[model samples]
Target: MEINPAVTFKHDRSIMYAKRPKVLIVGAGLAGLTLGMLLHKADIPFEIYERAQEVKPLGSAMYFNSTTANFFKQCGIYEEFLAIGKYVSSIQVFNEVRGHEFSMDFEGQEAEFGANGYIVARPVMYDLLLRQIPRERIHLGKKVLTMDQGGNGVLLRFSDASEAEGDILVGADGAYSAVRQGLYAKLKKAKRLPSSDDLPLPFSTVCLVGQTRPLTAEEFSDIGLEQCQFRRTIGMEKMYGWATFTTAQNTVAYNVIQFLTDETSKQNDAFRNSEWGPEAAMAMCEQVKDFPIVSGDDKELTLGDLFEWSDKNHISKVMLEEKVFKTWYDCRTVLIGDACHKFSPSGGVGATNAMHDAIVLANRINGLPFHPIAEEIENAFREYKAERVEWVQKAFDSSKAFKTMTGQSFASKATRFVSKHMPAWLFQRIQAQTCANRPQVAFLPLHNDTGRIKPAPQPSLSVRAPVEAETPVAATTATATTTTTEVV
Candidate 1:
């Protein structure tokens, strides 16, 4: 009936929930589940909390980075994931103005850096990661309400009238992260992104996802679905991006998901419930339902249902433009994955970066001494946040730029120039390299551009993905002087 505060305790492995310095992972989504798996691999005791009554199939599919493949391989699920996802040779970007012309292309093995890139269904990905952990470790239907830190450690409270204590608490509950909000409230006395009144760009958009009737290899080839493909809007006016979800060589998924950015400005936080609306989110699924993408037999369609994701319908009603997001943690409590950072789905780093957070944190947990583990909570969190925030910020910046460019701003002729001149290869390579590598200054979130460097001694974290210094920093210029690979 009444809620309590968070406290710290000496976690004892003998008892499951009593483990001191125990990890409380909120939001059982990709980040939470992956973090649990990594901790499990390192023999660390952790508890994952999810507010969902059950894992719901909200979005259609997710895109995985090549680096993520390494984590998956480490988890011994690389092959299994390969089975569920669409593995493509490359990711191609095209300029729609040039008759949907090709612009950039990134190809090759992720092993050079870490993992391979793939597109997979959100639910399936969630289920796969969830399977890696024991049923007891993940507590569903538990919503985090708040967290408190004393001299010793931290205590966590849930809306379900439940309380737990640990040395470190991770807010993995996603964009509307309670732990993050609670921690930031206590630590900074200020709100974080998404949770605040920061309204996402009012530009309207539709997310259409569905299961198709499966496609033949010939049909797929005809549509140029051989490898992963992308098509940008003309003059970057309409954000149209789609990829194939091929798990096996011949097995094309009947389910294809497409994201299209528009400027129709539908009402904020409203899910268009019509089976078919002018801006139905699942229209892409409907559009391709009869496509040749098939599983095995032509009789069965890979699709089970069509769905849409609206800001209002999201588990967390936060948007990319939201300034005060889910939550923030300093010291005893911390937030990771979507719980801490929510970017435009277009960023494509949401799942990958979240998994990265879990993996990197898990690695540190495995490497730390048990005694220091409890006290060194900040150290581990620092490492995770440092690396994750920078990368996530990059992802966010990219998504926002792309959204702005393609959202059809009549006043914006800059989008036209960018589409006509900027080399698509540059973006693809930049993303691939960034996702696959980490920078030495991984801990700091602020950019050291134009004399913004910090003299802090950087540690070796295998994160030198090249984009930190190599690519253009959130700026597009005229003349296109950079000698980037001109793919189109």
Candidate 2:
């Protein structure tokens, strides 16, 4: 069915969506949620489907700086985030024996970037993103078993024997995304998929992460401080590493990473292939219980205390894989975040990069013409990739470097020595480059860049006039047979 373009106005923003393609997102993750919020703001029709019956707070905590702060302001949740986030002054790194090695100070970030660094519990951040959209739009327990897209439209078959069709399909799902699998299967059969994309994701690190229950000042003195207590401990002779952060909720979030050598990675093939759940998490907890935690007030603590205080059901153990797929989209199907690129958690930019993917993709999608065809949709996908691929590669490389620096290999020790002794001027130069690309929603009124250091150019930005009234203007420039189908 041929449909005319639609101009939907909400508040002060007006966006012209070419037929307003019904977006079917296959994951309600950070990337998916960020995309949904932008589409919602533009009055574009979209729905998110998650395989989990209920979303769990699996990861530990996430740090946010200028990279994503503007998007939070665009979503009108910046103030809320500030309220829940614990400001981070610096991240202190120590040796296995509690001797301070080095520190990454973020003291002047507020003045330089217009936003201070902050760390919040992953669950808290997830909840903040969840509340932006209407509850009815998110369909939980809808596991997508298969996906197919033709020249005209896209379709999804869920595990419950139900099906959904839309003009566009987004694979925002995680590393093992079913949507990606389906797309790759088709590409492989047609002899179009790249050989590297066909390989399984390789990994050298496994992580266990969780957030403890709220504690009193007596229980954890660091919780009383205004600044986030971020600490990292690198084992000297052991393969294990650990970190902890004090959050605004009077809770401590911790992560334990075990670097696996070539032999060890090969040895854990069975465990790596098995599904991860509470049982896997509990078993890992027992293994890393003895790892020491750096705390203020000279108090002694260990990973076991945090694990004990945390709900066992919330802790998660998963492999940290780093890969950027060569193929991101085909026809009406595309991907975002982990579905396309998976970065190690060492850089603390995995979630930030995921949301960045969503922002750029949404901007490109909003620029589609009044009556877009398969070619046009693919063009938008290509443009999105073109604009984001460079940044994604940079993030992947940065994350990998950090992962190597924290490993127990001899090369890791050398990298740490060089990093610890790096000149302050050179270090700041690298830091400046890393924080230079802060993208925002283009169709909306752009957030004023108040940072001293300007952000990198955003090629996907599409500035449009803001609507003046409450009623939305609908475009009716097509034939009488034109119809709009809303996804239920």
lDDT score for candidate 2 against the true structure: 0.83
Worst 10 residues of 1 by lDDT: 479-488
Q: Give the top-scoring candidate (TM-score).
A: 2
Residues 338-382, candidate 2: write the lDDT tens digits: 999999888999999999999988887776544445666776787
- Please provide TM-scores, in order, for all candidate models, with all chains considered together: 0.65, 0.90
Clash pairs, candidate 2, are none
Error of 1 at 427 (Å): 5.5
Best prediction by lDDT: 2
lDDT of 1 by residue, 1-488 (tens): 22223444564333332232367777787888877886776556788888767775444457775545544555567688877776555433433323334343445444434445676766677788888899998787887776677546567777889987665678787655667556655545543333342333232444444322334554444223444433333334333333334433332222232333332234434543212343443334455433322222233232322122122132121223312232344665667776666566555666777776776666545434333323345555555555456556677777666555544465334754565476766655555446544322222232322211212222324222221122221221111112111201
Candidate 2: residue 146 Cα off by (Å): 1.7
Report lDDT (Cα) of residue 221, candidate 1. Answer: 43
TM-score for predicted model 1 compared with the true structure:
0.65
